[model samples]
Target: MSAAHDLPTTARPLSPEQRAADLRAMTEGELDVLVIGGGVVGTGAALDAVTRGLRVGLLEARDWAAGTSSGSSKLVHGGLRYLEQLDFGLVREALRERSLILHHLCPHLARPVPFLYPLTHRVWERFYVGSGIALYDTLGGRKGVPGHRHLSRRQALREFPGLRADTLVGAIQYHDGQVDDARHTMFLARTAVHHGALAASSARVTGFLTEAGRVVGARVHDLETGEDLEVRARHVVNAAGVWTDEIQDMAGGRGSFGVRASKGVHVLVPRERIQSSTGLISKTATSVLFLIPWGRHWVIGTTDTDWSLDLAHPAASRADLDYLLEQANRLLAHPLTHDDVVGVYAGLRPLLAGESDATSKLSREHAVVSPVPGLTIVAGGKYTTYRVMARDAVDAAVAELPDAVPSSCTEKVRLVGADGYEADWNRRHRLAAEHGLHVARVEDLLHRHGSLVHEVLALLRADPDLARPLAHAPDHLRAEVVQAVRAEGALHLDDVLARRTRISITVPDRGVEAAEEVAELVAPVLGWDQVRAAREVRAYRERVAAERASQAEPDDSRADAARLVAADLRTGA
Candidate 1:
């Protein structure tokens, strides 16, 4: 068969043993490409390269989506605000990507979400906002999702009873895509692995392997086992996101491009706090606020400001919370307070620097540069456009290869869980009944795992106790905790609580109450001893406490200090 016809198969389960094997494989021979950083772009780049039949390896210092990818507004849309800035091309590109994800690539993980844009002015505001929304709908085309619709104040209030009467004269409702960013990124890596890419998380790159003033591969430190390995590759692609500069320094000096970190914070409030049928979007003084619908909660966020502090933990200050609460209160009939916020999270965006002083004004358009003969660096793009960034980075890397490489076929590639999802969903009731579970529980698993949900179901069959819910957080099944370590690459308790499942951010105690129980459940799978399991539980508690303290701080510096109180468990703090 021609390499061009290579298609992804059902992803092999991302177990710890598989991760160790991947690291060993990278050291044995020279790979065509070595991807550094495991964010959306990094994993996406790995997927893009492997689909082209290139031998590829992916490395991450932390777990997948531990960086900016997981901490997003969770909306995949054409930049509605960008339309006002006249960045029509960017908007159109994002809309097309949004449509692709909604209908083709990851329909199981990504779904249509409606947002209401309230208009304050009677005449001009409606005409102006409606036109932009109409353009947004037009750009998205007719098939994937619904179009925009205009509503009067009365009709709008009927649709969204949470809106304050004085907030707007009318509203425009539109559709966009939403996803579980962390799981989606993990799935992307699994898809790459399925198509023959070596993938490992918690493997930190210590330095670049260089010869005769050219790049070769990297020296990596395995965090889990405390072992070091050398990885050799003809071409190295850096999709390190905000840490692009650090990776460049390891390579020698600053590559032709620069990235600036911008902090964005979000708070999760209980669903009943907002009596709305659809999500809410409105302009803030600096950027915008989105009230997105999470399962049993509403995520309201985002303050975009320049961040120069710690990249790993972007602290959400009291002022950040106040700003969001104040803005959200303006639109809500019932004001939300600090007591109402169940969880808070902050993430940093890597924007292309030197364009403008304001981080918000910086371009999200990614750049791929070949600073050295064997190294390629790609940075600065939104999560919605990661595939394009990945494609471009691979193209640049392939240009340096001595031989011709196949073109990117990732656009046609449906992620591992996407294939046969519709059929699986149609049989969800039958599957649920056979498994002795509710249909809604199966639906949740289907959305999280798609057609591969059968794998999770097999675990329940092997052990019936896996069917029980977590004592503290009932939304997730106990089997998921075991699956996180056994199947997905969840090494630490934090990985299971924070990313693999959203227990850390969904529950009011931030998974502290469930940490001990969940840790015990996963300990056997991960081979954690009693002492190690206790330490993991303690680390998670410290993390939650630090985040709480950080959120209480009045300013960024203070917040950063508070958050730093809990050093990363992976780093042995």
Candidate 2:
């Protein structure tokens, strides 16, 4: 392994200055590895490469985790459903990664979340489901969380009072992990930058640079500045998730495997709507439905069906919303209606194409293939095992290099906020007193930013006005808006509301009420004039309106058409 002293001494914020510097540095010299896509895996690959003492550059067409990464069920688990498919190895691997993420890697971002698996059948169901949960706990090595426990129908009712009496005779509670997927992915990108990787968002790879029919680099277009530049790299890793096939075409060759996009839609409702101490996960006919507990809301989802619509904006149709509601209503004592839904989001899963026509049955196993000498394409894996996928991609990219490269050391490298998280959490009350904030607010900051809460606090100290809570979105402080821009690389209003703070999904108006205030809050930091700031607020309102219209549509085609009516701020349609 490379010595720690060889890398940069301290971490740098993903501010505008750092972004401009990184973009210029990418063109000045040839990078050892250039990672396409700023989703979880791509950012992970960049971190892996940089920590291995390799020059790395990571580019994203939009904001980090703007794609499928931001729109996940937000669970880090062993895929308990996969064990029933008899894919024990995949389950074990995922479980191991889950433990690492919850315990060692990003403890602040990822943590234990318990779920109740209600059993309908009186005898056979209990035996089968209990055995599976047992195996799951064992497979994960019982490291980060506690073991599962079986409960009778009466006992289960005590734990989850909202469950219908006829739905299940008993329940088994098990532990998994949950995370804010967008923030976690952003942390990956920032950590990579800290480890000496040139990372930039709003930078799209337009084409591949080839010499002698071998891929050498990429032709990148800066979406923000509208300038085109060449980023040369000895090797490139395509971790483009759902758009993997399109990237292969740009490389002038096709890989051995094909990627299929499976759409998954999730709906967020107020926490009071679900009377459960723990989350609920029940098996559906096609796939499983998860009622994961977020801070002020319960995230219920999802449908597993083939989606060939807009790759960038996967719209959740009225049918999708109804399906989720119907599924959740089956177990709830008081059936939920469309009015209960606070927010809805749709995302595409890059499943590896297989013999089965069902997208749900497609393989979650990732494949790393080199269609060209200098390029490697990695696609199709669950979010929990991103580190393993990233490690494999970096391993493949380094194989072609002449110099002997160091192995990936990311397993031991904590994310930006992991270190001293426990200590900060322990003294959260003191922090709250010092910062002149409530203990609950300080605790929330600790959970979101971990030990890096101090950085956000610094912003509050610098500008006392930033400590005020957002008028419409009270859960998030105004300081978070500035922190998102100054540290987390948020360049647009959507980036802050949708990904950085999740104000877009947690609120009833889908952040429309908070959009103008948020846009104004970050305008100075982003160097946005009155015109630009107004444009951003207008664009955000249009986006919310388009999404609402899309959700009202009955099917995918109509929903996609409705969604496309609003032009993205970055692309302008």
Candidate 3:
């Protein structure tokens, strides 16, 4: 076994042994900041704080990005619609972050993706929409991506062959960044660990540890081992996203601001279903619809409606699916039905509640407040500006410390696997030759693991069978599953299929056929026997079944009830 000191700081693996060590460290020392939640904002806050030379500990109730972070539309662009809402500052901030993500932060994980906005009305609409995109380009600095392009009806049809000729008089194409949200969040947590911060997933913060009405730390419950630990810190940051209110209540007060949950659902269809080279974006009655081009699939989505159901499992009802299909069909020459959808996912947005009853009108602006003397609550921001949210949250926490701390410098800190990504991509063919794998396969691994592809290559060197692709999920190698457990902090089969590899959403069976194979592959690394492995597979299948049943329901209440039938394995329901 390699010693902790022997590994490169950027390459430190979040293996099971590392998790145990982190948990022990959390209990042993009083950290400078203790972060609650492991979503993008929370993990980003942990990374920001640790890099500022402060001792930090991050805790997540479930798997990393298991909630809202994993369920995003997977775009990292300035909200073009928000510009219509007259939010210029937010748009400018997000566009700057988008540029940083594509160029500096996680170049391997995020890249520029083009989207075409179909204009139905002839001259007026074209000028209006085209002007907004031009302004968007100006604010974005036109740095890492191309500026907007105006296409006539003939040109638009040529670019997107699947579009209906009658629906679009013209189109405007703009560029935005896209990423694997789950893997990006996991990388944030691991990057914090690399900077000497302690982080443990499946560790729920049950209550706040208070000292004479000032928040000090938290009472954490480890779902994996069923152990309760008291982690002490000088200050605590509640970056819980939609769960912000719940954490604030534990801190013993209603926070200064309120967070309302808005349900957004996305559906995945085969790439061939829409013969578009670029993505599609259109205006909806409530919000907007996006048809994003994911690998081998087109991700169409998003219905913005208020949700008051189960916060953990936001269900996508039949109405939600129909609404999305109805919107997408308005533009597509070939209408898509329910049969065309291979996968569906739902996520909740933590919108800052305003006077408007419609969640769509709620503000995406974030607020950072110290509810108590030492507890800081950061909530209500979009995914594109997570780094700014993290920086502001850490700034608030650092204010309460006795000594003066440095300002946020995360803009300069590249995430683990970001360094040397370009050089690795240039030499991907050589790597494939060395590993006796296809160059295409090596390229895929480079995108997912960046310069860290060498670590996965070592696995193939030791056990060549691991290089074989999974029978059901041919896009992913068996070695990827092993790496998910041994390197990425994946404790459950769902973590590997659903988050680490995305086999759950890409495959037709939603990873049901791959569950047993993935379970057996990671069992030894996780110290699970045959019975435990079988139990994990059974739990994953039940979860998939419940999700399917929920999608068939008519409304949110019924869908929530259907989804509740599958108990969470970590919590045992």
Candidate 4:
């Protein structure tokens, strides 16, 4: 798949043994830098460091973005809420990055989305909001995103007819960008690898490798092969996000600073239930609930609260579910219930803990520290500013390197799909027509894969059999599954379902009936025998069943126990 786009090819099949050998070789060469964590920030750091002419390697315990990165609300915004707290520096920085991404980098992965912020009062409220939005526009250079437009009550009703007349006196419409967080993150990893950053997932970092009382590298476990690898480097940077403390403990440090995990949950409901083209941003008594347009579904969320649980897989409690429903229903014409919730996701935000009791007050400002001489830890930045965080992390590590590594140039390094996306996007119609695929379908692929759409289309062209849709989830084209395994580092069915395509939670059956077909598609690349293929498919189905069952459980303890069954099933596979 990657060959069509001229993307540098990874080995046809990525095996743990091959990965370990590569890591050991890089370490023996005494790498310039090694980044711990495979989330967006970590991957970004790898890209930044490598592009700056440093020999780099990245290690992740699970698949890319399996942690806090994939669990976000998926908005590329300047944290509008932070504006309320007078976080001018953060808002300005995030806004600049948001523009950089939408207008320059990853345009295909991130696109403009319109949202209406309803105003309950007229004169005073309008002036207050209008002024704030005006400042917001100035901060980002706005590009061409329409400046906030005021809408009268009747006009607002026409635009958002489903909203109760009592809810708003008017509205302010503005634009922000949204992204497929997991897909974009995967692309970052691939881009980093393309730029010569050694990237590996399903490889667990067992502990830090120290020399003379300083961390020099890490001892990683190849979960797939049950072997250990010692990767040595001059600088070890931690961009672990929420798992920052865990890595710090392995290195015998204080984590440089405290990190707090705040849980935010989102629910998916059918889009037809909401009668509006524009998304809605409403104020909750405490936080905010957004009813965003998510293709065929409306993503309504989220409840931000403190969480102390199995940080790996946070179970959304019964209370958490009810709280979200109660808040979101207040705006719906017909309130959503458990049945309307076809999918649910919970994400943890790794905020820098502050004096305030509230998580909302926690600083989104990121700090880079050489907690130990050889280790540079970066944490606490928003998604929009990931590139900036990465650049800073690489800069910190450069100071520790034995030889001076040139400054990061990733600010100009567009991701793999960014080049010529617009021109190719314009040609999508002609190409889709020639291929006998719907134009809308072509646009979807272009947006998701960007200029790399040709790579996926080539798979369909090579094998007409690959052009069909996934058996259960017709929304996803079959070629996409093959592409996921071949080029996108989807080594397992869970990787394909959960992050690569998000079919697991996006659909009601959690993609059970589609599992076998997906497994069949990936089997050729993964070299799985029939027994292993069947086991992969079955494990995915049980994972879905367990998640569905856990959601129905009355409380967190039951939900936690039930969720464990799913993990146990996957392990048994």
Candidate 5:
């Protein structure tokens, strides 16, 4: 290997200064490709383009993965239920992607998680479900994760003691990949930057820049500074998730294809509530319900229903919460009530609109189209296959270019912190000793930052005060809050408490009690005054209150109304 090939793929830090530099670079010269949206696909598209040696610029209306990307079920499965629908191709494609992520692309952030499917019927259910799981394992090639294994009722109960005895006669255990979706997406954006892509969050595309009849680039408004500029590009790709239709309209009018929004909600409970060694996946009347294990909590979710309400903040209704709780409680020995929920969240999936009346029946398959001469729109896909979607989108976007554009090299590109991760993990105990912390803390940091945990430890070594855990949230060190701003592009307290860390949903207070401390910790890096810090805290508390109020409402209308009560700190609702 050459010296260049031997060099590590370093992750460039995303800071306030870097954001300003990226914004400046976006306006200085015309980019080869300009991508809209900061979700998984958008960031993935940027990574794909930049690695192909294209001059790329990515813009996001809000923080990275603040949308549906962050709010997913956090699974990178092959859509096990899709097998029942006979969508073998989609399942196969997703399974391949899952394998790639688990073993190659993002091993540190994504890992294999086991899911137990409880059989209600003895002979028929076991045969039927067993065949499907076998096909699922076969389709996936069973390279990175484990294959399906059949278990008797006694064995099933041993794996999950909290399950009701009457719920199942036997079970089948299978493996799927799990991730910290928010951090994964953020890392994607950062990796793109490391590979030479200019990206800015809270930068909204207000309008499209046009030539006589051909699309040119985009007119963006910086939400942070309230400055507007025209960013010219050779080709512009819109990867907005559920907001695809809105972007299409901004381009000119609705395109030939349409994207519909399907609402899915999830709730968090204490991990002790489910005494299971493995996760649970059960069939529901409308869709599938997952009781996946989070760090210290269990994430029980989701109801799939057509939604036509606020796109930015989709509210979780009382019915949605009740439906999930009811469905999950059916199989649990001890039923969980509203009081057991520590956090509540809702996200909208951008499904391709077509013949099926049911939103759940909508296609997860994606489409990439050049709506105009210099504009491309890509949407409609599951999070697991974002890389394929991005690769296809870029291929379409660069087809009309005058010069030859290289094919995507992202498949071979390991994400930042992924390189040398295994070796770093093996030395974690030594790292803990060197840093004067417990092995558990070192392991947690390693998982969160992979090889870059050294950078975070450096911060703690400089400021001993940062070594202590946050007052309200003890799981995270105060240095992580500073790291969120200094390295992860966290501009506001909510960014730190919510996306940058899992404090918001994982904590009982939804990070309300930690809001002030976090705000103060990030204030210096973000250049916030004491008054601004106080304001950020107040806004975060109000936002949490509004979310709680919305979760109490019976329907979408009341829920949306309650959620809107707390105006968006950046956009003011």
Candidate 6:
């Protein structure tokens, strides 16, 4: 994964001085766009605008994808549920983007998965469900991934024997893509950086640098270092999905559309506990629930409802959990329960425009506007169609720029890990033998890190101890933790656990017991002293404990308070 020296992969904290230097070089020597927020959409926008030959700088209030981006159902599907709502335009756009990621842009990161839609009613239900899935398949996205297949009861049972025999008469198994949402967002930011974009996490936009009623740039606080730095640009793009209005206000006023926060909660369980080869998608009375396959865990979620809780930490309430378990358990042969839950994660979706009465009916379509001079805000849109949103955001920003801007080149851009991934995968056995690890273990690392596995492998070569798996969570190698701290800009233990590796949610006890071990692993790379490391571990545990306690609460208000009580161990805190 070595590249030009401009994009260094070093074991050092990102500095405001370095960013300021880069910012100066960007604005004085070259300039086009400055994007705020580090979610998938913002990262995508940065990559898009920069590759279009614009000098770009992207800043995030927290880590990339720390907000809604990390808290997805982890599926890159075209929203099959949207089809029933007659949102053909939305579904088609997403399906097309899903194809681009699967077949081209990030083939390694986004891979197809099969999901069985079990039919409860006999003849009518089968036909109704079959037609919907048929359209889902034939809409013929930018196509390399497979199509949907109809299954008889016998065939469906063969595919997933865990379903209750009496519950479903037949099924339709359809294909969709999935990804590590947080990692993908991080990669997006990294790819943007690789292309000469100055991207920084934990850089919050406190106020707009305005003069004569126009946003010139932003006044940002480097949360980790405790310094305020001004980053100026000719045009500013606010791709802040959830906090679009907040940024708009900072830019001097609010926009025509308002972004409402909707909470989506997901629970994690051991993979084998599901007893299904294919994932499951079921209809709920109000919404839908998807059973997704994570690496070692099965992600069953997600409960969607409007949430006005603390934006940072959205806790899944007991009622929400009850609703999901009740819905999913309707057809399962073995019912899931509280004890089966290893982790609970809730993400807030920025349902923009606030135009719909029903949360499920709310649009995922994004809108871009220059609510004020020199500022562009792009909000809404599903995760699947982020590139489109990015492209749109850049187009609007281009209008504000006084000079000609190059056409976007990100459609052809591959993230660091995408290139040479299949070849490395084909040589998995050799990699395993060479590294003295099991072929399965090597394959896991290969898929997760792609060609960048060599980066961690290089670390292990430097220190053999890095090759040993973590004491608490044996699934992830200790080297990966160190690599995250060194190369991935993991500012804290919670960042490493919650988003970087997902060990916090995948493991039981929310990685409480693993916190100290992880703190020890990342300390040397991050230059953490005994006090810093211990404080990190303690903070992470307290956060997890607070989330756990919050889930036991009855409603969002109590849950929000409890989750906030943990005091956010993030770099911003």
Question: How many clashes in each structure?
Answer: 0, 0, 0, 0, 0, 0
Error of 5 at 154 (Å): 0.4
- Candidate 6 clashing pairs? none
After TM-score superposition, the amount by which residue 416's alpha carbon in candidate 2 deviates from its true location, in angstroms, is: 0.6
Q: How accurate is candidate 4 locally (lDDT)?
A: 0.82
Name the weakest run of 10 consecutive residues (lDDT summed) in model 6. Answer: 1-10
Candidate 6's C-alpha runs over 4 A off are 1-30, 570-573
Q: What is the lDDT of residue 412 in candidate 1?
A: 90
lDDT of 2: 0.92
Write down the lDDT that model 6 would get: 0.82
* Model 1: per-residue Cα lDDT over 1-573, one tens digit each: 111112122468677778988889999979999999999999999999999989999999999889999999887878888898898888888888888888899999999998899999989988999998898888777558888899999989998998899988999999889989999998898899889999999999999999999999999999888998999999999999999999999988998879999999999999999998899899887988999998999999899999999998899999999999999998889999999999999999999997589988998888999888899999998999999899999999999888889898888999988999999999999999999999999999999989878777767777777899999999999877777777677889999999999998999989999999998887776778999999999888999999999999999999999999996877775
Q: What's the lDDT for residue 18 in model 1? A: 85
Candidate lDDT scores, in order, read 0.89, 0.92, 0.92, 0.82, 0.90, 0.82
Could you give candidate 4's per-residue lDDT for residues 1-573 as a string of tens digits? 323223333322233333545566665767888998889899999999889888899888788898888888889999887788888889989888888788787999998888888898879999998788878888878784777788998888788777877778898888888888998888898888877778788777879889899888889887777777788888899998888988888888676588898888888888887788888888787678888898888888787777767677776767777888887777766777888887888889999888977887788889888888899999998888999999999898898666766887877888888887999898988989988899999988888888888777778777777788887898899989888877787778999998989897787887888899898888877778999899888788877777777677777778767766765322342
Off by over 4 Å in 5: 1-10
Per-candidate TM-scores read: 0.97, 0.98, 0.98, 0.95, 0.98, 0.95
lDDT of 6 by residue, 100-188 (tens): 88878887677888899988788898888889888887775538767788788999999998888888888988889998889889888
In candidate 5, what residue range of length 10 has the lowest lDDT sum?
1-10
Clashing pairs in model 3, backbone N/Cα/C closer than 3 A? none
Note the residue pairs that clash in candidate 5: none
- For residues 388-482, write the lDDT of model 2, one tens digit per residue: 99999999999999999999898899998888999999999899999999999999998899888888887777778879999999999998888
Error of 1 at 460 (Å): 0.7
Q: State the TM-score for model 5.
A: 0.98
lDDT, candidate 1, residue 307?
97
